[model samples]
Target: MLFDRRAPYDFFSVYHVPDVVTQRQFEAGIAASGWYDYFEQVNISGAALSPVGALLNNVALLPPTPQGPQIPPVSPITKQRVNVLGRTMTYADEGAGVPVVFVHGDVMSSFLWRNVIPHLDGQRTRSLAGDSDKLPDAGPGTYAFATHARYFDAWMEALDLRDGVVLVGHDGGANVTFDWAMRHEDQVRGLAFSEAITPPFDWEDWPAQMRPQFQYLRTAEGERDVLENNFFVNAAPQSITRMLTPAEFTEIVRPYAQPGEDRRPTTDWPREVPFDNDRSQTRTALEAQAAWLADTSIPRLHLPGVPGGIARLGGRKRRLISTWPSLIEAPVPGLHWTPEDAPHAMGSALAEWLRSLIN
Candidate 1:
């Protein structure tokens, strides 16, 4: 997105940006500028947005109309597609040198890294694989995209993430980052996790969980609706249980009605991606993590003290923070249970941690 020349000021969404481009920044600096208006800015989550979609109008793309005035100059950040994990992955990259793979968590594509991606001081690059879409649904029972971001090696082929990398993860993504270090300890220079959770459940201390979640196959006739409804309810953020307004309760969430190809929900995922492999193979793979953490000696960070996340759906456990602390001697910075409560602080801590690497 480029902001050629200038115009009026605007802050239209909950996404807070302090980059002061409010036509005032341009005018007050060297010349006087015009007034403000109520033109609503557009927004769409990146994973759901097409590169050509209308919402590409991030501040970088807002243009100066022929009749209207222009402001300060800005340019579109050129994008690159690298063959990491076999697929031609689209990503944003800048800087150079020892790389850091800031893997995004499930439900969110790469958009969650937006704040930290732009703040690195030097010699660093970030890349993301647009692998969020489910594998072509060949049949009812066969599902892919099952939070497979958990695998580090296979995914690297699809993304040109920094080689010999620093790995970072948040929430469910923490397992991916730490697990990556375990598998590729030599390739990894350092590891950082925020709001991380590793296996070993402590349900005894859990707040009231409504009930066990269950799923039915697409072949099951009437049960499909029941399966879909409970699926999303389990994946919902705490806000759904707390602050979500009635309208939000409906419009924001209620759409998991057996999603079709077009009208699908990905902003917040519904559950652990349906496991694609046989139950035996998948369980063996997941259960190997604790053993791996017990062995990982790569420099690490464990960030806990964040809001609780959806703990379980069916029988699989959510990331349990207490299960893996041996990996970190000094805990990463943040308050317990509400770290993401302040993104600026999280972003800063992440930036500083990465810089601390090879410094």
Candidate 2:
């Protein structure tokens, strides 16, 4: 009486009848059969109907049950660090083909490009985002562009990344890249900048609204405010349209969270606003970079973010963009953190642009 004799697919045909009628014994007997093994292999997802045990077909080949979306797990990233020019620099090297180097701005490190580098496939792209907070102090009044440029140049040399390498710089790092492009124009194949600062524009010329903010950052009180409050680290995650997850925020802010005055780079950066054309290293470095931007024949890309925000290039940037006929300006959607805020758009555009150059 336990068998449904009239059923089309008889369950008893696939399973052996056991003398013991206990459900556990029945299951064990069915499990030993090849048909039962085949059914077990077929994954049934979603809610299975009771009584008749009906399952809606999802994957047609297998007798389907209700199921949720299958999302693949993401691979973990591995960070690489090296002693370049006596300072420890961190970067991520991935993919293959053309060599592209990514440089990050102050208050941020290579982690900024986490969402972008993967898109630059078919090329060996290394995102170099060193934490200057941990670097040895280069004495008081030392300008970041001059000091960091040396470190960056040394890093390139250490890696034997000499000539024909594409350089992409973001925010303050653009200044460093520009300085290098000017000094060693022959070494670089092309240049790309996003939310960058191009000189000839001084703190005095800074937008009326932002001048006070910069002025405050020049003070000792500002240094305390920045460190105690985690200004750079906290600001970036919040400023973007898409707020970063807690884990992403933790990784980005890790370097700046370290104790001691070595973290002076955070405050030193705001103080080094290239304004005067006098003997100031800041002025000299920026002016030279400006000159390079004006004259270099190298292919260039500029991704201008929304104006008026923390890192978006404003009027000065637009004016500079106008003069460089060879520089290709690509519009990106975002304020300061284009890589994080607009990864898909930025990455795909960048990849297409780079491919065009290669072909």
Best by TM-score: 2
Query: In order, what lDDT does every prediction score?
Result: 0.43, 0.63
Candidate 2 Cα outliers beyond 4 Å, as residue runs: 1-75, 123-133, 137-143, 200-210, 276-279, 308-314
Candidate 1: stretches off by over 4 Å:
1-79, 83-88, 123-131, 138-152, 158-163, 202-237, 240-258, 261-280, 307-340
lDDT of 1 by residue, 147-239 (tens): 354435555644545357877676556666665666667787777665444344333322243223222322243234434444433344332
lDDT of 2: 0.63
lDDT of 2 by residue, 144-173 (tens): 666788888788787777767788888788
State in Å the error of residue 197, model 1: 4.7
TM-score of each: 0.55, 0.72
